[model samples]
Target: MYSPALQPLFQSLLSTLADLNLAYDRDREKLSESMKDANLRTRALEKLKQQHHERREPYLQQLAILQDRIQRGWH
Candidate 1:
């Protein structure tokens, strides 16, 4: 049993520590979620770049072929 004179001080201290713990947990969760979102975005961007490169490679080859044909025709 707590002494009546010390009960209020203990209660206030307990409540303050509980609030601080809750806020700290919330901040930690938010940071974890943000990091996960950033990782996903980075992966998506890398995939998009890879797809663009694959799509453009054929076009570049065709342009080169056309340029060679034009040069040979002129000579």
Candidate 2:
């Protein structure tokens, strides 16, 4: 039975993608909650959006790198 050593890379790619989706969902949920709360200010919403971008960027980069590696198809 031959297995490509790229399994870990594939796993990481899938996990990173799922994490990116979760981060997006969190951002949407936070915005929805903040929008519903009158006491929360516009600054709070802006901060949440910024936080989401900051958090998701690394995962986005990692996913791109992993896909690149998989595409290379190492022997």
Question: Global lDDT of each model?
Answer: 0.57, 0.70
Number of the top-ranking candidate, with lDDT as the measure: 2
Q: Name the candidate that leads on TM-score.
A: 2
lDDT of 2 at 65: 72
TM-score of each: 0.46, 0.54
RMSD of 2: 4.1
Which residue pairs in candidate 2 collide? Answer: none
Regions of candidate 2 where Cα sits further than 4 Å from its true position? 1-4, 16-31, 34-40
Q: Please write out the lDDT profile of model 2 over residues 17-74, one tens digit for every residue.
A: 6886798778767676758665474667677678878877877787677667666764
Assess candidate 2 and give its lDDT. 0.70
Q: Predicted candidate 1: what Cα RMSD to the true structure?
A: 31.7
6-74 in candidate 1: lDDT tens per residue? 445545555655665576556555555665677775765566556656655655565555456555762
